[model samples]
Structures are given as C-alpha cells and as structure tokens.
Target: MIDFLTAGLVLGCSAGFSPGPLLMLVISETLTHGTRSGVRVALSPIITDFPIIAATLLLLMNLSGYHGILGGLSLAGGLFVLYTGYHSLTARPVQLDLPKEPPKSLRKGVLTNLLSPHPYLFWITVGAPLLTRSLKVGPAAFVAFIGSFYLCLVGAKIVLALAVGRSRAFMGSRAYLWIMRLLGALLTFFALLLFREGLKLLGVG
Candidate 1:
C-alpha cells in the first residue's frame, strides 16, 4: 500500500510538472483568462484519464498470462519515461501567447487530453500494468494508487495555476526551471527502476 501510494505520488507529480502541451494550455488559459480557467484545465485529466485507463486495462488483461509481453511493455514504458525526463531536463521557458478567442478552459483541456497520444501510451504501457498489480493486492490498494495519483496530478497543476495567476512571469522563472530539472532527475531514477523491473520480468536480471 505504502509503495503504491509513493509510486503514485511520484509519477503524478512528475506528470503534473512535466512540460507538455496540456501544461502549456494551462498556462495559456491562466494568462489569457484567469486562475480559475487554468484550474479547470488542470482538472481535465480527472475527466479524461479514466476512460483511457479502462481501455488499456482491458487490453492488458487479455495478455496478462504472457510474461514476455508484459516485460516488453514495461521496457516500452521505461523508454517513454526516459524520453519524458529528457524533455524535462531540456525544458525551456514557454512563450505564452494568448489565444485570440473566448475562454473554454475545461472544454479545451478535455479535447486536448482526449486527442493526445500521451495518456493512451502511458496507460497502455505503464499505468495499466501497475493497476493490474494493485488489484492483486486489494481494491483498497488500487484505490490508494489511483487516488493519490490524481490528487497530486491535479493538485500540482492547481498550484501552478495559482502561482501563474499571482505572477505572470512565473512560467519562465528560474525557480520553475530548477523545479522541473529536479523532477527530471527523479523521473530518470524511476525510469531506471522500470528498466530493472522489466529485466526481472524477462528473467534476465
């Protein structure tokens, strides 16, 4: 339970803070509309991720008996995480150009997330496998993992919305860069761990 919770928190925070299209949207909304708008954007994953997760979990369940396939998926997940971390390490300050349109924070966010490949890839390769394992431990453990994940995920973005609202320059600040770099370092560590897990599943480590 503790392990799952910790894993969820780390992954959630990394996902939340990671520089991506969704995050850019959050900042754009905040700068263009207001903190509330950005916050609505942050809450999007809560609305979008579950369906992706469900679909991925169903797909993985069919292949659950195959260790080789699961190992391969874990390796893929590690590579993906490594790629994400590399981007974070090389992150640059976003140029916030306000959209010349009305504010539809939640709708835009939902559409963006729904159309993005990241969530699908993450769930298929990493999230579903973790969820499958958690179910073996118990429903409570599964809930803990997912609950903590979204809690930190949405919470971090909400905090970012608040920060950006307070200081428009917050997105391009040295503090933001350092924080992302730190998360990148942590993500690298997690990626290595994923690789180890993959190897173990493959009976190579």
Candidate 2:
C-alpha cells in the first residue's frame, strides 16, 4: 500500500513537472491571464480523466482473461516510460513564446488533455494494472493511490504556474535541471519495475 502511494505520488509529480503540451499551456495562460487561469488549466485533468479511467478499467477488466495481452501492454508502457525518462534526462530549458490569442485556459486545457495520447496510453497500460492490484490489497490503498496521484499532479502544476507568474527565471535555473534529472531517474526505475513485471507475466522471468 505504501509502495502504491509512493509510486502514485512520484509518477504524478514527474508527469506534472515534465515539459509537455499541457505544461506549456499552463505556463502560457498564467503568463497571460493570471495564476487563477493557469490553475483552471491545471485542474483540467480532474475533469478529463474520469471517463478515461473508467473506459480503461472497463477494457482491461474485459481482457483480464488474456495474460498475454496484459503482458504486452505492460511492456509497451514500460518502453513508453523509458522514452519519456530519456527525454527528461536530456531536457533543455523551455522557450515560452506566449501566444497572441486571449487565454481560454479552461477550454483549451480540456481539449488538449482529452486529445493527448499520453493520458490514454498511461491509464490503459500502466495505471489500470496498478489500480487493479491496489484494489485487491484494500479500498484505502486504491483511494490513496488515486488521491495522491491527482493531488501531486495538480499541485505541482499549480506551483509551476505560480512560480512562472512571478518570474520566468525558475525555468532556466540549475535547480530545474536537477529536478528534471531526479524525476528522470525515478521514472527510469519505475520503467524497469514495469518491464520486470511484464516479463514475469509473459513467463519469461
């Protein structure tokens, strides 16, 4: 249970802090409108992810009889996380060129999140398995995993928005590079764990 919670928190924070389209939008909106606008964008995942989670869970439940399929998905997810981690390890400071359009932060955020493939792939392959396993341990563990995930995910984005709103210097700071590298290491570790689990499920371990 503690492991689940820890994984959830780390993954969430890493995803939130990592440079991506959504993060760019958040920074752009905050720079243009205000911290409140950026916060609405940060909260977009809460609105968009419910349907995604439900659908991913349903699909996985229906396919639960096929361990091979699940194993394949685990491997794919592991590879995807490795890709993300590699990029994080090599990340450069973002060049935030604010868009000219007025900030429709909420609507843009919802659309961006919904259209993004990363969230869908993540919930289906990585998150679903972890959630299913956590549920068997206890409902509290399941809830803790989900609750901590979103809390850290949204919280990290909110902090970034605030920081950027105050000054853009934080983006180029040495601290930022260190944080990204640390997150990259954590993600790589999780990817290895997922890969091992995949191999075990495939009867290759």
Candidate 3:
C-alpha cells in the first residue's frame, strides 16, 4: 500500500514535470491570460483521464483470468517506464515558445489531453494492472494510489504555472534538469518493482 502511494507520487510528479503538449498549453495560457487560466489547463487531466482509466480498468478486469497475458503486459509496462526514465534523465531543457492563438484555456486543455495518446497508452498498459492489483488489496489502497497520483500531478503543474507566471526564465534553469534526473531515478526504481511483480506473476521470479 505504501509502495503504491510512493510509486503514484513519483510517477505523477514525473509526468507533471515532463514536457508535453499539455504543459506547453499551460505555459502559453499562463503567459497570455493568468494563473487561473493555467490552473484550468492543469485540471484538464482530471477531466479527461477518468473515462480513459475506467475503460482501461474495465478491459483489464475482463482479462483477469489470463495471468500470463497480464504478466506480459506488466513486463512491457515496466520496460516502457524504464525507457521513459532513461529518456527523461537525458532530456534537455524545455524551450517554451508561446503560441499567438487566442486563449480558450479550458476547452483547449481538454481537447489537448483527450487527443493525446500518452494518457490512453499509460492507462491501458501501466495504470490498469497496477490499479487492479491495488483494488484487490483494498478500496483504500486504490484510492490512496489515485489520490496521491493526481494530487502530485496537478500540484506540480500548478506550481510550474505559478512559477512561470512570475518569471519566464526559470523553466530553462539547472533546477529543472536536477528535478528531471531525480524523478528519472525514482521512476527507474519503480520500474524495477513492477518488473519483479511481473516476474512473480509469471512464476519465474
């Protein structure tokens, strides 16, 4: 349970801090409108991800009888996370170039997140299995995982928006690189955990 919470926290923070279309929109909105607009963008994931997660969980639940297949998915998810961590660790600074379009912050944010492939891919491959496993442990464990995840995810983005609103130059600083590397390390650790879990499920651990 504690591990689930910790993994959620680190994974959420990593995703939140990573450069993406949604993050770009957040920065652009903040630069154009205000912090409130940026926050709305940060909140987009909450609105968009529920359906995706639900569908993924539903599919995973239906497939629960197939342990070998599920184990393969878990192994793949772990490998994906390991790849993500390595990419993050070697990533360069984010270069923010604000778009000239008018700000429809909430609508644009929703569309951006919904259309993005990352959320769908993540929920299907990584989040679903983990969430299903947590649910088996207890409802509280599942809630802890999700609650901690979104709290850190949205919180980090909100902080970034606020900070960027105050000073635009901070996004390209050394602090960003350090944070990325730290999150990468944490993600790598979580990936190992997931891989081990996969191996156990496959009866090979």
Q: Which stretches of candidate 1 lie over 4 Å from their true place?
A: none
Model 3 per-residue lDDT tens digits across residues 2-118? 277887898899889988889888998998888899999999999999999999999999999898989899898898889889977987878888777777898999999999988
Q: What is the C-alpha lDDT of each candidate?
A: 0.87, 0.87, 0.88
The deviation in Å at residue 86 for candidate 1 is 1.4
TM-score per prediction, in order, is 0.95, 0.96, 0.96
Which residues of candidate 2, in runs, are more than 4 Å off? none
List, residue by residue over 1-205, the lDDT tens digit for candidate 2. Answer: 2278987987898889999989999998998899999999999999999899988888887877788988898899899888888888998888897886787899999999999888988898788878876877889888988999999889999999999999988878888888889889988998998898888779997
Clashing pairs in 1: none
Candidate 3 residue-wise lDDT at 159: 93
True-structure RMSD, every candidate? 1.5, 1.4, 1.2
lDDT of 1 by residue, 1-205 (tens): 2268877887898889877789889988998899999999999999999988988888888888888999899899899888888888888886777776699999999999999888888898878888988988999889988998899889989989999999988888998898889888877888888888888889998
